[model samples]
Target: MSRSHIRHELSKLESCLRKEIGELANKHQIKLESKQSSLCEIIEVLTQAKLCDEPLFCRLTKLDAAFCQLDIGLYGLCADCENEIEPERLAWDMLEQRCAECAENYEHQHRQELRLNH
Candidate 1:
């Protein structure tokens, strides 16, 4: 795929993520202010919000980095192996920084580490 096309996709992803983050933040704030629930219930809500917000924030950060890389003509290349990421995967998620193989390996290692830590 062309660099222009990739840039366009990344832009769309960034816009979508920003909108989602905004909505999530707004919903969390509204829930916190309007809900009159038990402390446990409030904590549960907060925990759920945190779980959703954290990942969105992470994706936003990654999208920002991808924009920077796109500006520098480095987008679509895997961070670990420096291979061009598959077009289909890029279409699915422009923020992904690893090729399929590297991503699988990274996820495997991460899971192993999580198990060991547990």
Candidate 2:
């Protein structure tokens, strides 16, 4: 796909993520002031959570970085092997820049190193 097309897709994904985060915040009642201080604390925690994208702003920021890479024609290209990621796999996850085989091999080697430490 063209650069413009990829950007357009990223925009759509950002919008969707924003909408979902908004829904999550509302569902979790993450208001500035609540009966329990824990509610506000949870919202603040969401702002920094890396594994879970509960806050709309934080999630959009991460997506923006990926879109920037896509704009530079670096997206979907493996960082390790410099190989083009398979289109079929990209269809499942556009954010995946590394090939599955490379990732598996890397993980296997990493595990062997940990085992040696013991």
Could you estimate the TM-score for every candidate?
A: 0.70, 0.59
Q: Which stretches of candidate 1 lie over 4 Å from their true place?
A: 30-53
Q: Estimate the Cα RMSD of every predicted model relative to the unseen true structure.
A: 8.4, 7.3
Would you list the clashing residue pairs of candidate 2?
none
TM-score: model 2 vs. ground truth:
0.59
The global Cα lDDT (0 to 1) of model 1 is: 0.71
RMSD of 1: 8.4
- For residue 10, give model 1's deviation from the true position in Å: 2.1
Error of 1 at 45 (Å): 19
Compose the digit string of candidate 1's lDDT tens values, residues 4-49: 8877887677666556655665866735421334324433454666
In model 2, the runs with Cα more than 4 Å from the true position are 31-45, 49-62, 106-118
